[model samples]
Target: MTFRKLMIAGAAVALLAVGATAAMAQTSAQKALIDAAKSQGTVGEQADGYVGVRTNADAELRAAVDATNNGRRAVYARSATEAGTTTEIAAARMFETQLLARVSSGQWYRNAAGQWVQR
Candidate 1:
Protein backbone atom coordinates (compact mmCIF):
# COMPACT_ATOMS: atom_id res chain seq x y z
CA MET A 1 0.00 0.00 0.00
CA THR A 2 1.11 3.55 -0.68
CA PHE A 3 2.39 5.58 2.30
CA ARG A 4 -0.32 8.20 1.73
CA LYS A 5 -3.05 5.56 1.79
CA LEU A 6 -1.66 4.04 5.00
CA MET A 7 -1.54 7.47 6.67
CA ILE A 8 -5.15 8.21 5.72
CA ALA A 9 -6.35 4.89 7.08
CA GLY A 10 -4.48 5.46 10.33
CA ALA A 11 -6.08 8.88 10.74
CA ALA A 12 -9.55 7.51 10.17
CA VAL A 13 -8.98 4.78 12.76
CA ALA A 14 -7.74 7.32 15.27
CA LEU A 15 -10.76 9.49 14.72
CA LEU A 16 -13.07 6.55 15.20
CA ALA A 17 -11.33 5.60 18.43
CA VAL A 18 -11.67 9.11 19.83
CA GLY A 19 -15.34 9.20 18.96
CA ALA A 20 -15.91 5.88 20.65
CA THR A 21 -14.18 7.03 23.79
CA ALA A 22 -16.31 10.16 23.91
CA ALA A 23 -19.47 8.11 23.53
CA MET A 24 -18.47 5.72 26.28
CA ALA A 25 -17.62 8.58 28.61
CA GLN A 26 -20.83 10.36 27.77
CA THR A 27 -22.35 11.29 31.10
CA SER A 28 -21.80 8.60 33.71
CA ALA A 29 -22.94 11.47 35.93
CA GLN A 30 -26.56 10.82 35.03
CA LYS A 31 -26.18 7.24 36.22
CA ALA A 32 -24.71 8.62 39.37
CA LEU A 33 -27.87 10.66 39.85
CA ILE A 34 -30.16 7.72 39.12
CA ASP A 35 -28.28 5.50 41.52
CA ALA A 36 -28.46 8.14 44.17
CA ALA A 37 -32.15 8.67 43.55
CA LYS A 38 -32.82 4.95 43.93
CA SER A 39 -30.84 4.53 47.12
CA GLN A 40 -32.49 4.61 50.55
CA GLY A 41 -31.60 6.80 53.55
CA THR A 42 -30.57 9.83 51.51
CA VAL A 43 -33.99 11.33 51.99
CA GLY A 44 -34.03 10.23 55.61
CA GLU A 45 -36.69 8.15 57.35
CA GLN A 46 -40.29 9.37 57.21
CA ALA A 47 -39.34 12.46 55.31
CA ASP A 48 -41.88 14.71 53.65
CA GLY A 49 -41.94 17.64 51.20
CA TYR A 50 -39.94 16.76 48.08
CA VAL A 51 -37.71 14.36 49.90
CA GLY A 52 -35.32 12.30 47.76
CA VAL A 53 -34.29 8.74 48.42
CA ARG A 54 -30.49 8.53 48.35
CA THR A 55 -29.15 11.61 46.62
CA ASN A 56 -29.35 15.18 47.80
CA ALA A 57 -31.05 17.25 45.13
CA ASP A 58 -29.64 20.40 46.61
CA ALA A 59 -26.11 19.11 46.27
CA GLU A 60 -26.79 18.21 42.68
CA LEU A 61 -28.12 21.68 42.00
CA ARG A 62 -25.08 23.21 43.56
CA ALA A 63 -22.89 20.94 41.52
CA ALA A 64 -24.65 22.13 38.41
CA VAL A 65 -23.91 25.68 39.37
CA ASP A 66 -20.28 24.75 39.85
CA ALA A 67 -20.23 23.11 36.46
CA THR A 68 -20.84 26.51 34.88
CA ASN A 69 -19.55 26.76 31.32
CA ASN A 70 -19.08 22.97 31.33
CA GLY A 71 -22.43 21.94 29.78
CA ARG A 72 -24.45 20.80 32.77
CA ARG A 73 -28.24 20.91 32.93
CA ALA A 74 -30.90 20.50 35.58
CA VAL A 75 -34.07 18.42 35.37
CA TYR A 76 -37.28 19.66 36.97
CA ALA A 77 -40.78 18.53 37.83
CA ARG A 78 -43.82 19.88 39.71
CA SER A 79 -46.92 18.65 41.54
CA ALA A 80 -50.27 19.52 39.99
CA THR A 81 -53.90 19.39 41.05
CA GLU A 82 -56.49 18.96 38.33
CA ALA A 83 -60.10 19.64 39.16
CA GLY A 84 -62.51 20.41 36.28
CA THR A 85 -62.11 20.01 32.52
CA THR A 86 -59.67 22.88 32.72
CA THR A 87 -57.18 21.67 35.25
CA GLU A 88 -56.48 24.00 38.12
CA ILE A 89 -52.91 23.50 39.20
CA ALA A 90 -50.12 25.04 41.15
CA ALA A 91 -46.64 24.71 39.74
CA ALA A 92 -43.30 25.00 41.50
CA ARG A 93 -40.18 25.04 39.34
CA MET A 94 -37.64 26.21 41.86
CA PHE A 95 -34.60 24.99 40.03
CA GLU A 96 -35.87 25.06 36.49
CA THR A 97 -34.10 28.10 35.09
CA GLN A 98 -30.92 27.46 37.00
CA LEU A 99 -30.71 23.92 35.79
CA LEU A 100 -31.34 24.90 32.20
CA ALA A 101 -28.76 27.61 32.49
CA ARG A 102 -26.25 25.13 33.78
CA VAL A 103 -27.08 22.81 30.92
CA SER A 104 -26.76 25.61 28.41
CA SER A 105 -23.31 26.37 29.68
CA GLY A 106 -22.09 22.96 30.79
CA GLN A 107 -20.78 19.96 28.86
CA TRP A 108 -24.19 18.96 27.49
CA TYR A 109 -24.65 19.48 23.79
CA ARG A 110 -26.84 17.86 21.19
CA ASN A 111 -25.34 15.95 18.30
CA ALA A 112 -25.95 16.65 14.61
CA ALA A 113 -29.04 14.49 14.83
CA GLY A 114 -30.55 16.77 17.48
CA GLN A 115 -30.12 14.15 20.16
CA TRP A 116 -28.41 14.70 23.47
CA VAL A 117 -24.70 14.11 23.04
CA GLN A 118 -21.91 14.67 25.54
CA ARG A 119 -19.28 17.25 24.78
Candidate 2:
Protein backbone atom coordinates (compact mmCIF):
# COMPACT_ATOMS: atom_id res chain seq x y z
CA MET A 1 0.00 0.00 0.00
CA THR A 2 1.10 3.55 -0.59
CA PHE A 3 2.34 5.42 2.49
CA ARG A 4 -0.57 7.88 2.21
CA LYS A 5 -3.11 5.08 2.15
CA LEU A 6 -1.44 3.42 5.14
CA MET A 7 -1.59 6.67 7.10
CA ILE A 8 -5.26 7.15 6.27
CA ALA A 9 -6.07 3.63 7.39
CA GLY A 10 -4.18 4.16 10.64
CA ALA A 11 -6.03 7.39 11.34
CA ALA A 12 -9.37 5.72 10.72
CA VAL A 13 -8.50 2.98 13.15
CA ALA A 14 -7.40 5.48 15.76
CA LEU A 15 -10.62 7.45 15.37
CA LEU A 16 -12.73 4.36 15.83
CA ALA A 17 -10.75 3.34 18.88
CA VAL A 18 -11.13 6.75 20.42
CA GLY A 19 -14.89 6.70 19.91
CA ALA A 20 -15.24 3.28 21.51
CA THR A 21 -13.03 4.29 24.39
CA ALA A 22 -15.07 7.41 25.01
CA ALA A 23 -18.29 5.42 25.07
CA MET A 24 -16.89 3.15 27.74
CA ALA A 25 -15.29 5.87 29.82
CA GLN A 26 -18.35 6.64 31.91
CA THR A 27 -18.63 5.44 35.48
CA SER A 28 -20.99 2.60 36.26
CA ALA A 29 -23.31 4.85 38.20
CA GLN A 30 -23.38 7.44 35.49
CA LYS A 31 -24.00 4.82 32.88
CA ALA A 32 -26.85 3.41 34.91
CA LEU A 33 -28.51 6.76 35.28
CA ILE A 34 -28.04 7.62 31.62
CA ASP A 35 -29.37 4.27 30.55
CA ALA A 36 -32.37 4.61 32.78
CA ALA A 37 -33.02 8.09 31.54
CA LYS A 38 -32.76 6.93 27.98
CA SER A 39 -35.17 4.10 28.59
CA GLN A 40 -37.55 6.51 30.21
CA GLY A 41 -37.40 8.84 27.19
CA THR A 42 -36.14 11.67 29.31
CA VAL A 43 -32.75 11.95 27.69
CA GLY A 44 -31.19 11.03 24.38
CA GLU A 45 -28.11 11.13 22.22
CA GLN A 46 -27.86 14.27 20.13
CA ALA A 47 -26.55 14.44 16.59
CA ASP A 48 -23.95 16.99 17.62
CA GLY A 49 -22.46 14.28 19.82
CA TYR A 50 -23.84 15.30 23.18
CA VAL A 51 -26.61 14.22 25.50
CA GLY A 52 -29.90 16.05 25.37
CA VAL A 53 -32.66 16.17 27.94
CA ARG A 54 -36.05 15.71 26.40
CA THR A 55 -37.92 16.72 29.49
CA ASN A 56 -37.11 18.41 32.77
CA ALA A 57 -34.10 16.70 34.31
CA ASP A 58 -33.50 16.21 37.99
CA ALA A 59 -30.16 16.97 39.55
CA GLU A 60 -28.87 13.42 39.42
CA LEU A 61 -29.83 12.77 35.82
CA ARG A 62 -28.59 16.18 34.82
CA ALA A 63 -25.27 15.56 36.49
CA ALA A 64 -24.82 12.20 34.83
CA VAL A 65 -25.62 13.72 31.45
CA ASP A 66 -23.18 16.53 32.09
CA ALA A 67 -20.41 14.13 33.00
CA THR A 68 -21.09 12.00 29.95
CA ASN A 69 -21.05 15.00 27.62
CA ASN A 70 -17.88 16.31 29.25
CA GLY A 71 -16.11 13.06 28.60
CA ARG A 72 -17.31 13.09 24.99
CA ARG A 73 -16.12 16.66 24.53
CA ALA A 74 -12.67 15.73 25.73
CA VAL A 75 -12.48 12.85 23.33
CA TYR A 76 -13.80 14.90 20.44
CA ALA A 77 -11.34 17.68 21.12
CA ARG A 78 -8.39 15.33 21.16
CA SER A 79 -9.57 13.50 18.06
CA ALA A 80 -10.18 16.77 16.26
CA THR A 81 -6.67 17.94 17.01
CA GLU A 82 -5.20 14.68 15.78
CA ALA A 83 -7.33 14.72 12.64
CA GLY A 84 -6.82 18.37 11.86
CA THR A 85 -10.51 19.12 12.12
CA THR A 86 -12.86 21.08 14.33
CA THR A 87 -14.35 19.52 17.46
CA GLU A 88 -17.86 19.79 15.98
CA ILE A 89 -16.85 17.78 12.93
CA ALA A 90 -15.13 15.19 15.07
CA ALA A 91 -18.21 14.88 17.25
CA ALA A 92 -20.58 14.52 14.30
CA ARG A 93 -18.39 11.84 12.79
CA MET A 94 -18.19 9.98 16.06
CA PHE A 95 -21.93 10.17 16.50
CA GLU A 96 -22.65 8.88 13.02
CA THR A 97 -20.01 6.13 12.94
CA GLN A 98 -19.79 5.05 16.55
CA LEU A 99 -22.14 6.42 19.17
CA LEU A 100 -25.33 6.21 17.14
CA ALA A 101 -24.58 2.60 16.28
CA ARG A 102 -24.56 1.74 19.97
CA VAL A 103 -28.04 3.08 20.63
CA SER A 104 -30.22 0.18 21.65
CA SER A 105 -33.69 -0.48 20.35
CA GLY A 106 -36.26 1.65 22.20
CA GLN A 107 -33.62 4.19 23.12
CA TRP A 108 -33.83 7.79 21.95
CA TYR A 109 -31.48 9.76 19.71
CA ARG A 110 -31.72 13.13 18.02
CA ASN A 111 -31.48 13.02 14.26
CA ALA A 112 -29.42 15.45 12.25
CA ALA A 113 -32.57 17.36 11.50
CA GLY A 114 -33.04 17.94 15.25
CA GLN A 115 -35.77 15.37 15.50
CA TRP A 116 -35.81 12.86 18.34
CA VAL A 117 -35.80 9.34 16.97
CA GLN A 118 -36.19 6.02 18.70
CA ARG A 119 -33.72 3.36 17.72
Candidate 3:
Protein backbone atom coordinates (compact mmCIF):
# COMPACT_ATOMS: atom_id res chain seq x y z
CA MET A 1 0.00 0.00 0.00
CA THR A 2 0.96 3.66 -0.34
CA PHE A 3 2.69 5.60 2.41
CA ARG A 4 -0.38 7.63 3.26
CA LYS A 5 -2.50 4.49 3.42
CA LEU A 6 0.07 2.85 5.66
CA MET A 7 0.15 5.88 7.91
CA ILE A 8 -3.60 5.84 8.19
CA ALA A 9 -3.58 2.15 9.04
CA GLY A 10 -0.92 2.68 11.68
CA ALA A 11 -2.90 5.53 13.17
CA ALA A 12 -6.01 3.39 13.31
CA VAL A 13 -4.13 0.62 15.05
CA ALA A 14 -2.68 3.07 17.54
CA LEU A 15 -6.07 4.53 18.27
CA LEU A 16 -7.53 1.11 18.95
CA ALA A 17 -4.57 0.28 21.16
CA VAL A 18 -5.05 3.37 23.24
CA GLY A 19 -8.78 2.95 23.41
CA ALA A 20 -8.29 -0.58 24.65
CA THR A 21 -6.45 0.86 27.64
CA ALA A 22 -9.05 3.52 28.26
CA ALA A 23 -10.68 3.13 31.61
CA MET A 24 -13.93 1.55 30.75
CA ALA A 25 -12.65 0.58 34.17
CA GLN A 26 -15.58 2.19 35.86
CA THR A 27 -15.47 3.42 39.42
CA SER A 28 -17.82 1.71 41.86
CA ALA A 29 -19.67 4.97 42.29
CA GLN A 30 -20.21 5.28 38.56
CA LYS A 31 -21.23 1.66 38.18
CA ALA A 32 -23.56 1.91 41.12
CA LEU A 33 -25.12 5.04 39.64
CA ILE A 34 -25.71 3.32 36.34
CA ASP A 35 -27.14 0.29 38.11
CA ALA A 36 -29.46 2.46 40.13
CA ALA A 37 -30.57 4.27 37.06
CA LYS A 38 -31.31 0.99 35.32
CA SER A 39 -33.22 -0.40 38.29
CA GLN A 40 -35.15 2.77 38.95
CA GLY A 41 -36.33 3.05 35.37
CA THR A 42 -34.24 6.19 35.36
CA VAL A 43 -32.40 4.98 32.30
CA GLY A 44 -35.25 6.35 30.29
CA GLU A 45 -35.15 9.60 32.20
CA GLN A 46 -31.38 9.86 31.93
CA ALA A 47 -31.65 8.99 28.28
CA ASP A 48 -33.95 11.89 27.85
CA GLY A 49 -31.12 14.14 29.03
CA TYR A 50 -28.58 12.20 27.01
CA VAL A 51 -30.72 12.46 23.88
CA GLY A 52 -29.69 16.08 23.54
CA VAL A 53 -26.09 15.22 24.26
CA ARG A 54 -26.10 12.46 21.68
CA THR A 55 -27.93 14.52 19.11
CA ASN A 56 -25.64 17.47 19.61
CA ALA A 57 -22.48 15.41 19.29
CA ASP A 58 -23.78 13.79 16.12
CA ALA A 59 -24.67 17.17 14.70
CA GLU A 60 -21.26 18.58 15.56
CA LEU A 61 -19.42 15.69 13.94
CA ARG A 62 -21.61 15.93 10.86
CA ALA A 63 -21.01 19.62 10.57
CA ALA A 64 -17.26 19.16 11.01
CA VAL A 65 -17.30 16.51 8.26
CA ASP A 66 -19.37 18.66 5.95
CA ALA A 67 -17.14 21.63 6.52
CA THR A 68 -14.05 19.56 5.85
CA ASN A 69 -15.57 18.32 2.59
CA ASN A 70 -16.39 21.82 1.46
CA GLY A 71 -12.89 23.00 2.22
CA ARG A 72 -11.23 19.99 0.62
CA ARG A 73 -13.42 20.35 -2.44
CA ALA A 74 -12.04 23.77 -3.01
CA VAL A 75 -8.46 22.56 -2.53
CA TYR A 76 -7.63 18.89 -3.17
CA ALA A 77 -10.86 17.84 -4.86
CA ARG A 78 -8.90 17.23 -8.05
CA SER A 79 -5.88 15.60 -6.43
CA ALA A 80 -5.00 12.15 -7.72
CA THR A 81 -5.46 10.18 -4.51
CA GLU A 82 -7.91 7.77 -2.95
CA ALA A 83 -11.60 8.44 -3.56
CA GLY A 84 -12.31 9.99 -0.15
CA THR A 85 -8.83 11.06 0.87
CA THR A 86 -9.56 14.73 0.52
CA THR A 87 -12.71 14.88 2.58
CA GLU A 88 -12.60 11.87 4.83
CA ILE A 89 -8.94 12.35 5.62
CA ALA A 90 -9.53 15.93 6.57
CA ALA A 91 -12.48 15.03 8.77
CA ALA A 92 -10.67 12.16 10.41
CA ARG A 93 -7.65 14.35 11.04
CA MET A 94 -9.88 16.97 12.59
CA PHE A 95 -11.55 14.39 14.80
CA GLU A 96 -8.29 12.77 15.84
CA THR A 97 -6.88 16.16 16.64
CA GLN A 98 -9.94 16.93 18.70
CA LEU A 99 -9.88 13.61 20.48
CA LEU A 100 -6.23 13.88 21.44
CA ALA A 101 -6.52 17.46 22.56
CA ARG A 102 -9.84 17.41 24.35
CA VAL A 103 -9.75 14.38 26.61
CA SER A 104 -8.42 15.07 30.10
CA SER A 105 -8.59 13.91 33.70
CA GLY A 106 -12.05 12.39 34.35
CA GLN A 107 -13.76 14.49 31.73
CA TRP A 108 -17.34 13.78 30.55
CA TYR A 109 -18.95 16.66 28.73
CA ARG A 110 -18.81 18.46 25.42
CA ASN A 111 -18.17 22.15 25.73
CA ALA A 112 -19.93 24.96 23.87
CA ALA A 113 -17.58 24.81 20.88
CA GLY A 114 -18.20 21.08 20.60
CA GLN A 115 -14.91 20.16 22.25
CA TRP A 116 -14.89 17.68 25.14
CA VAL A 117 -14.73 19.33 28.52
CA GLN A 118 -14.30 18.05 32.04
CA ARG A 119 -17.53 18.01 33.97
Candidate 4:
Protein backbone atom coordinates (compact mmCIF):
# COMPACT_ATOMS: atom_id res chain seq x y z
CA MET A 1 0.00 0.00 0.00
CA THR A 2 1.02 3.57 -0.50
CA PHE A 3 2.17 5.73 2.37
CA ARG A 4 -1.16 7.51 2.65
CA LYS A 5 -3.06 4.24 2.67
CA LEU A 6 -0.79 2.83 5.32
CA MET A 7 -1.28 5.88 7.48
CA ILE A 8 -5.01 5.73 7.09
CA ALA A 9 -5.08 2.06 7.88
CA GLY A 10 -3.06 2.63 11.02
CA ALA A 11 -5.36 5.40 12.12
CA ALA A 12 -8.41 3.30 11.44
CA VAL A 13 -7.15 0.37 13.47
CA ALA A 14 -6.25 2.62 16.35
CA LEU A 15 -9.60 4.34 16.20
CA LEU A 16 -11.49 1.07 16.19
CA ALA A 17 -9.66 -0.22 19.21
CA VAL A 18 -10.16 3.01 21.05
CA GLY A 19 -13.74 3.46 20.00
CA ALA A 20 -14.65 0.01 21.20
CA THR A 21 -14.64 1.46 24.69
CA ALA A 22 -17.70 3.60 23.98
CA ALA A 23 -19.47 1.44 21.41
CA MET A 24 -22.51 -0.60 22.14
CA ALA A 25 -21.65 -3.96 23.53
CA GLN A 26 -22.71 -7.11 21.77
CA THR A 27 -24.85 -9.58 23.65
CA SER A 28 -23.63 -13.08 24.27
CA ALA A 29 -26.27 -14.40 21.92
CA GLN A 30 -25.18 -12.08 19.18
CA LYS A 31 -21.59 -13.12 19.72
CA ALA A 32 -22.66 -16.72 19.47
CA LEU A 33 -24.47 -16.03 16.23
CA ILE A 34 -21.37 -14.51 14.70
CA ASP A 35 -19.25 -17.35 15.97
CA ALA A 36 -21.53 -19.93 14.46
CA ALA A 37 -21.63 -18.12 11.16
CA LYS A 38 -17.86 -17.89 11.03
CA SER A 39 -17.47 -21.55 11.91
CA GLN A 40 -20.04 -22.50 9.32
CA GLY A 41 -18.44 -20.32 6.66
CA THR A 42 -21.73 -18.61 5.99
CA VAL A 43 -20.96 -15.06 7.04
CA GLY A 44 -17.68 -13.23 6.80
CA GLU A 45 -16.11 -9.88 7.46
CA GLN A 46 -15.91 -7.73 4.38
CA ALA A 47 -13.08 -5.42 3.40
CA ASP A 48 -15.34 -2.51 4.18
CA GLY A 49 -15.63 -3.48 7.85
CA TYR A 50 -19.14 -4.80 7.49
CA VAL A 51 -20.35 -8.37 7.81
CA GLY A 52 -21.22 -10.20 4.62
CA VAL A 53 -23.28 -13.35 4.31
CA ARG A 54 -21.86 -15.53 1.61
CA THR A 55 -24.79 -17.94 1.54
CA ASN A 56 -28.45 -18.00 2.33
CA ALA A 57 -29.26 -17.37 5.96
CA ASP A 58 -32.36 -17.70 8.02
CA ALA A 59 -34.14 -14.55 9.09
CA GLU A 60 -32.62 -14.57 12.54
CA LEU A 61 -29.08 -14.87 11.28
CA ARG A 62 -29.62 -12.11 8.78
CA ALA A 63 -31.10 -9.90 11.42
CA ALA A 64 -28.20 -10.49 13.73
CA VAL A 65 -25.71 -9.58 11.05
CA ASP A 66 -27.63 -6.51 10.13
CA ALA A 67 -27.64 -5.32 13.70
CA THR A 68 -23.95 -6.00 14.12
CA ASN A 69 -23.01 -4.20 10.93
CA ASN A 70 -25.16 -1.25 11.78
CA GLY A 71 -23.45 -0.85 15.09
CA ARG A 72 -20.06 -1.22 13.47
CA ARG A 73 -20.90 1.39 10.89
CA ALA A 74 -21.89 3.84 13.55
CA VAL A 75 -18.56 3.41 15.25
CA TYR A 76 -16.67 3.73 11.97
CA ALA A 77 -18.58 6.83 11.02
CA ARG A 78 -17.79 8.47 14.30
CA SER A 79 -14.14 7.61 14.03
CA ALA A 80 -13.96 8.80 10.45
CA THR A 81 -15.56 12.10 11.30
CA GLU A 82 -13.15 12.71 14.13
CA ALA A 83 -10.22 11.81 11.90
CA GLY A 84 -11.40 13.92 9.00
CA THR A 85 -11.76 10.99 6.65
CA THR A 86 -14.68 9.34 4.96
CA THR A 87 -16.47 6.49 6.65
CA GLU A 88 -15.64 4.14 3.79
CA ILE A 89 -11.97 4.90 4.17
CA ALA A 90 -12.06 4.23 7.88
CA ALA A 91 -14.01 1.02 7.38
CA ALA A 92 -11.83 -0.25 4.55
CA ARG A 93 -8.71 0.40 6.53
CA MET A 94 -10.10 -1.10 9.72
CA PHE A 95 -11.18 -4.44 8.31
CA GLU A 96 -8.71 -4.89 5.51
CA THR A 97 -5.69 -3.92 7.56
CA GLN A 98 -6.50 -5.48 10.91
CA LEU A 99 -9.56 -7.68 11.08
CA LEU A 100 -8.56 -9.81 8.10
CA ALA A 101 -5.29 -10.75 9.74
CA ARG A 102 -7.09 -11.91 12.87
CA VAL A 103 -9.69 -14.07 11.19
CA SER A 104 -9.15 -17.68 12.20
CA SER A 105 -9.14 -20.70 9.95
CA GLY A 106 -12.44 -21.99 8.59
CA GLN A 107 -13.85 -18.47 8.58
CA TRP A 108 -14.84 -16.68 5.43
CA TYR A 109 -13.55 -13.24 4.45
CA ARG A 110 -13.63 -10.93 1.50
CA ASN A 111 -10.28 -10.38 -0.07
CA ALA A 112 -8.99 -7.05 -1.27
CA ALA A 113 -10.23 -7.99 -4.71
CA GLY A 114 -13.76 -8.34 -3.31
CA GLN A 115 -13.78 -12.11 -3.63
CA TRP A 116 -15.06 -14.35 -0.88
CA VAL A 117 -12.22 -16.41 0.52
CA GLN A 118 -11.81 -19.07 3.15
CA ARG A 119 -8.96 -18.59 5.52
User: Best-fitting candidate, measured by TM-score?
Assistant: 4
Query: What is candidate 3's lDDT per residue for 47-102, written digit by digit as tens?
Result: 10120122223344344434433433333222213333544453344345433353
Shift of residue 116 alpha carbon in model 4, Å = 0.7
Q: Estimate each model's TM-score.
A: 0.20, 0.82, 0.26, 0.85
- In angstroms, give how far residue 52 of model 1 lies from its true place: 38
lDDT of 3 at 108: 43
Clashing pairs in 1: 70-106, 70-107, 71-105, 71-106, 71-107, 71-108, 72-102, 72-103, 72-106
What's the candidate order when arranged by decreasing TM-score?
4, 2, 3, 1
Candidate 3: worst 10 consecutive residues by lDDT? 43-52
Cα lDDT tens digits, model 1, 69-106, are 12211111111111111111111121221222323322
- Between candidates 2 and 4, the lDDT winner: 2
State which candidate has the highest lDDT: 2
Runs off by more than 4 Å, candidate 4:
1-10, 22-24
* lDDT value for model 1: 0.29
Ranking by lDDT: 2, 4, 3, 1
User: Which ten-residue region of model 2 has the weakest summed lDDT?
Assistant: 4-13
Flag regions of model 3 displaced more than 4 Å.
Answer: 25-52, 55-119
Candidate 2: tens digits of C-alpha lDDT, residues 17-49: 775787688888999998999999999989898
Clashes of 4: 0
How many residue pairs clash per model?
9, 0, 0, 0
Model 1 segments more than 4 A misplaced: 28-119
lDDT of each: 0.29, 0.82, 0.37, 0.80
Residue-wise lDDT of candidate 4 within 3-101, one digit each (tens)? Answer: 766667667767767657524466668769987988899899998888899999999898889888877877788777766788898888888666788
